[model samples]
Target: MSTIEDAAVWLAAADPDPIHARRWIGSARIILLPLGERWSAVKVSEHQGLAAAAALRGPSIHDPSGQCVYFLVAPHTVWDAPGSECLGESYWLTVPTPAVKEPPGPYWLRAPDGSGQLVDAEELRAQLGARSVSAAGAASVKQP
Candidate 1:
């Protein structure tokens, strides 16, 4: 099965409250919260279009100590599958808010038609030009 299919199966089985599942279908950044090993809360960025780019270039969210964050980037169409149920047709970047203790496994970056790529946290961060923060208050960018 394709990665998207696997993600769909996981979403259906893992996410109990589908209604609250956070998603964005446009040019925006989203902060996600994990539901067990799955994503639960998706907080979309207020910035859109060019504004979204500016936000990404800006400072990282002030997270508490020892938190790890992950990001996933994809086009909006990937959620159009029968069960995906997403709305919109723009580029999207998804991240985990409040961060996770360890790195999140690979996530799906789907297109509007349900085709996409499976990328891990480090790759996503590199693509976004984001810097990884250490517990000791140091930050460094990981080149792809």
Candidate 2:
């Protein structure tokens, strides 16, 4: 619905600490998984994972190089408190290394939980690291 850049600017000013992350996941390149609606939980699966979010809003690749630095920041479409404080959800963001091999398509970025372990959102937690955060106005239930 909106450009990725616009989302970035909004995210940048998200919280007291808005800078999502920078990553070098595995051998895959990763980027932001843009979604019009806030996500409740994200994981590293195909059917039920962050990849689904990627399907909603993605192809947000900055580069396809694993040799260089790439940002895997969380989408910053959140509700902010004063002083640019984020009071909302964002998955685990990272700065994925460039892809050793060229990424196939948006699919790579869509790999759930950043399959290939290449990407993550900004603030939220990884399924493996800590508990995942769920979006508001949604079910209280969670998934792996």
Output the number of the lDDT-best candidate: 2
Poorly placed runs, candidate 1 (over 4 Å): 1-7, 17-36, 39-118, 130-144
The weakest ten consecutive residues by lDDT in model 1 span: 79-88
98 Cα displacement, candidate 2 (Å): 15
Encode model 2's per-residue lDDT on 41-118: one tens digit a residue.
Answer: 233323223323333432223222322112233334333222122222533333223332234433234322322122
- Per-model root-mean-square deviation over C-alphas: 15.6, 13.7
TM-score of 1: 0.25
lDDT of each: 0.28, 0.31
Q: Native-vs-model 2 lDDT? A: 0.31
Q: Across residues 2-119, which tens digit of lDDT does each residue of candidate 1 receive?
A: 5434433333332344434323211222333333233221222322112222334211221223222222233232321111122223323243222222234312222111232322
lDDT of 1 at 124: 32
